[model samples]
Target: MQQQPGLLFTLASFVAMIAVLVVVHEGGHYLAGRLFNTRIEAFGVGFGRELFGWTDKRCVRWRVNAIPLGGYVKFVGDMNEVSQIDPAIMALPERERRGLFAFLPLWQRAIIVAAGPLINFVFAILILAGFNLALGHPSSPPVVDKVVEGSAAAAAGLQPGDRILSVNGTSIARFEDIVTEVVTGVGKPVTLDIVRAGVPREVTVVPKMVETVDRFGNVTRHPQLGIVRPAEVIEDVGVADAFRLAVVDTGSIIATIGRTLRQVILGERSLAEMGGPVKTAQIAGQQASLGLVSAIAFMAFFSINLGFINLLPIPTLDGGHLLLYGIEAVRRQPLAEKVQQWAFMSGFAALMSLMAVLTWHDFGSVGLWARLSGLLG
Candidate 1:
């Protein structure tokens, strides 16, 4: 098949992201199962035909499969003949009955299911903390990076080297402070004290309502001032600042995810705002092409996404399974088999439908259809 010049690179990145996330997610299940002494039949990375795998000490088959999208850990007896009311179990050999997933204690099963999502979140927090420790906290300094033409900053004669002193006479200590003031000051003229070209200057500008597009392609408006960070403003800080910045950034990302999800649920946002594998690959490829810093940043963002999605309370997801575990714990019994099957079917269908929509959007946004149509024409 003919390929786009850099298409393979993009696909590789997408695969890598999925593979790593799947391993981490499945590893959580494997660990939890081991802790509870549950029998693990197979732990496979990437679904489909097995490419290579080894037998672990516990006799579990550990292997990589041909598909790179994700992995799974099969628990013994998880869907055995006994649990499924299959007559096949009666005819099976005695050795096969020992470690079926249904035989495990309910508490153990719950823990095993919950661990996957928990690990994803833990991985995100760790990555955030590690990044902060390495790069230090990002300071919101009041410095101009860019002043686009016709923008509030440009209209106010703001220059790239300007250090903002105050916004509307309010003392600004950090860059984010200016943003906060600007967002709230939308449509209102605000005075800025700026130090530019080694001289203090004064400017006034109004924040404009700016349209913002999120990951899912939903658009919203917020106050914006077309000013960016100055290139020369890298203030050095101590370890304490780095740790603080990491925690703050992590919390901020999580809050943003929560808000985005809420918007989607409330119908304020559309599912198109969501990105599937195609978008991820394109983004990852773009980031990779940009160099190390950008790629690392993308990794951080992707990790947070991994954590967030896995926690959704949908059947076939870690969060959904955990929710079921909670119910089982309280009721002292498993949900009916029929109910579980239906729920899984519903969740799987929903996910597939979402994937199809996102994939179609991805192609359409990139003009793939137009390109193909042109060829036919």
Candidate 2:
């Protein structure tokens, strides 16, 4: 049977990506809790009412909840009133609770909270590595695939068949090297050695400084030769090269995320440029149309971003808990309950406000609200 790929496929893919990320994130908490000897009551794959659940011999209740947004693990002695604290735990002699979470050392508490983000980081690296291995190493041969008419390349007498041999008196062995020279030489006259129809020719072209936005919303200025990159044949790498490529790719993704955040902070981009869950589903549909490989790549990109965002030191997030633990470690005691309550409330309010604004922007971008307004009118 043929699989009909449509909006449904996109919706399913979006949910699946979220589910995988939730498991990895929450599994870290569950595993760390067990390692720290904390009693875990329930490990749920989603929130709200349980679709199905079962208890293990070790007394760990695992469940699939109806809501597909995220998952959680309920721990013993947690502040949540819903979790049943064993009489044994309460009676464990106040001395025992003293060193465990209700009693454990501060360092242990920090580690437990930190594990979730750490797992996410590891997941991103592994996914990138898997993709690189499967897709093959990228090649950078020096060839001009397309020359924009009236652009620098065309103005410099560059044709579609020109093979770049050197740039700005520098020898070029890789296509990437050629690109680096051209981009970095922006606003400077670059001397190019090209083999056009087997004739070695030299031309001087002043690169134009152009501003472009990366996928993560980063705006960058670079020299533009206005030539399109030709498709290079991919070659599978050895085990070592494959691993190295994965690491490099992961670093690139992290850098992109950082640049985008900086741009957002600097007001180089608007929140209207950001996408919410609705836009993400649409993107998933677009990727699915391209093929499975593209869809998987999209998932990896979003997963990396999700992991990075959750690590921000804001209240109600894992990073926020880590921040609190750090303060506790320094102060030699927990902060007042009232202070914690205030912080959490403030954080919740901020998050809700941001989400509301972003959702409106999303609806505006897709013209959903416009359609509804038209209907009313």
Candidate 3:
């Protein structure tokens, strides 16, 4: 929180990044509400005390709040940022009630609730598309272009031009997957299935842990099989191809997230591997310092994650709103107001608990606990 240059720069970059994504998210809701004829009372750029604001011609208050974390769109007859229907709104005139969010058609409400995540996905697609258009599409087949002398590849009989088929029985299609599996399974024996000279063979090897120092002198460790690609091959793609590949990239990302979550659920990953806002900010800052392209890539990944996470049918989130709509559709009636309130409360508690755990993990990652222990010792 102090004004150290590095910390300050990091906080600024994090706030700026969050502000961009949050505005995009809230703007999605606001625009959808407008399209659906729902009266949006306030469009806030941030949460917390309002620093300044202006009322638009349509009587919609646009506010910039003190907090730079995120933002929301407050619709008419809403009790809070989560868009809970105000109890008093029920007694309003029918004309007024019709304009309020509480009285909107279920279909329209669903569209408005869903628009936030929908636009996030759209943003990611467009960002990825832009990246592909500006920078050529990344294309690297699972072919070994180079083999280090006396390294794992050489020791395991991996020859140049060998096309990798799989790793430990998991088939790999992209060159990136080879690095991912090796990194994830570091210090473990792996069986690399390869096709050499049109003949299939298997090679056993253990990836060597390599220490890499970034420009900022940050040392990170990862497993390397000593096989390398001389240079990444990039192909220029047209608009249609870019868009199609963008969708494919998004799908791959979602699948990867699913696999990671499954691994965690199956106890293959430790809870300490998880992270929250602090980690996000730290990484965001680091990415920003790297370059604009790196930062944009990071934001795209985060935006997709945000969209995916919000679609889960947990209460107090956009997904939870959709869940309520689903229930109403099934029961042919709205849930009781008290029941909805309790559900929201339960959701809030769950989210806070998750945040607490993630924050604890962040502190540990930063060596806060270790530093404290040293002092107390």
Candidate 4:
């Protein structure tokens, strides 16, 4: 077996991953802002005190900050990195404020705000497409080789040789497709169209939540139907086809994320399963240890996740800005300054609270609390 990555290597991998993602995300905002001739004041990777930086010819301050958690692009006429409007900038004469972000047309502002998340999605798609072009697509026929006796598959009358046609009305061309569908539908009844003994039939199965423990004592729980498949087959894909498949795969991932979040909201999924920065770093390190390809794949997936999260309708996120812009478009006017401030403050608090909870969970997962107690005892 491959040796696990060391702590320092893990930390380095985590930082590298965050840094790359932040640069790409912030770069998106910077590019979009420049497109409309908006003046960018600063482009910094990470948050908090600046470690080192330099001003470019365009007068944009490029810097790397102390904290590696996230980054931002500070635009002219913005109060701070979050892009809040600066009253003084807004009050400037029209001609003097021409290139300021706050003075841009409403549509332009929306696009600039959205560019960050949109570019992340685009980048992920390109990475996946490249992988498909290089490695070809691997898949297996959606035929059940075996069904564990006590599994949901067997309970639903699934048998060896049954060919799955679709899951929950979505067509399934590969066994991997079935796995994706079933994994996300845990505890929920799934409708499957299948062919058994050359006869078309339908089956309903509810996947059981199963916990697996690895050799390192790490436990992971996922929903499973307990059906086995034959060896995977790799088929060469053309460039165009590779990109098309990549787009489809990206959409599927987004859908899965949405479904998982819905389950969490409905109390069907545990909060412990949700990972924060610490857990993410651990996973990043593990992926890095596997190989360059694995690490890159993780980056692509995480990029998609970063894009999706930022598009959420939370006040402090890109999505939140879009939400406000949407309301502005409908109202034909901007919201009052006090109201916007309150929204931003509330959103920041909500995000911080969520982060704290996830971080605590991360420490607990690694047995940090237990180790501390042991030391005290």
lDDT leader: 4
Better of 2 and 3 by TM-score: 3
Estimate, for each residue in 1-377, the C-alpha lDDT of model 1 and write its tens digit: 22232888777766776777788878998898888777778888887888988997889998788988777888765452112323345466767665555556766777777787678766666665666667654565678877888887777778887899998787877787676666533256788988987898888887777887644343446667788864333445556665566566666667667766786677766666667777678778777666667766777778777767877888877777777778888898878878988887788799889889999977766668899999999
Residue range 23-55, candidate 4, lDDT tens digits: 989889999999999999999898999999999
Give the TM-scores of the predictions, in the order they appear: 0.73, 0.75, 0.86, 0.97
lDDT of each: 0.72, 0.74, 0.85, 0.91
Shift in Å, residue 273, candidate 4: 0.9
- Return the TM-score for candidate 4, rounded to 2 decimals: 0.97
- Please state the error at residue 321 of candidate 4 in Å: 0.4
Which is superior by lDDT, 2 or 4?
Answer: 4
Could you tell me how far off, in angstroms, the CA of residue 341 lies in candidate 1 after the best superposition?
A: 0.6
Give the Å shift of residue 224 in candidate 3.
Answer: 6.0
| Winning model by TM-score | 4
lDDT of 4 at 131: 91
Q: What lDDT score goes with residue 238 in model 1?
A: 58
Return the lDDT, model 3, position 236. 98
Q: What is model 3's C-alpha RMSD? A: 3.6
Per-residue lDDT of candidate 2, residues 305-367 (tens digit): 777776777777777777887888889887887787777778768877877888888777667
lDDT of 1 at 48: 83
For all predictions, the C-alpha RMSD in Å is 7.0, 6.8, 3.6, 1.4
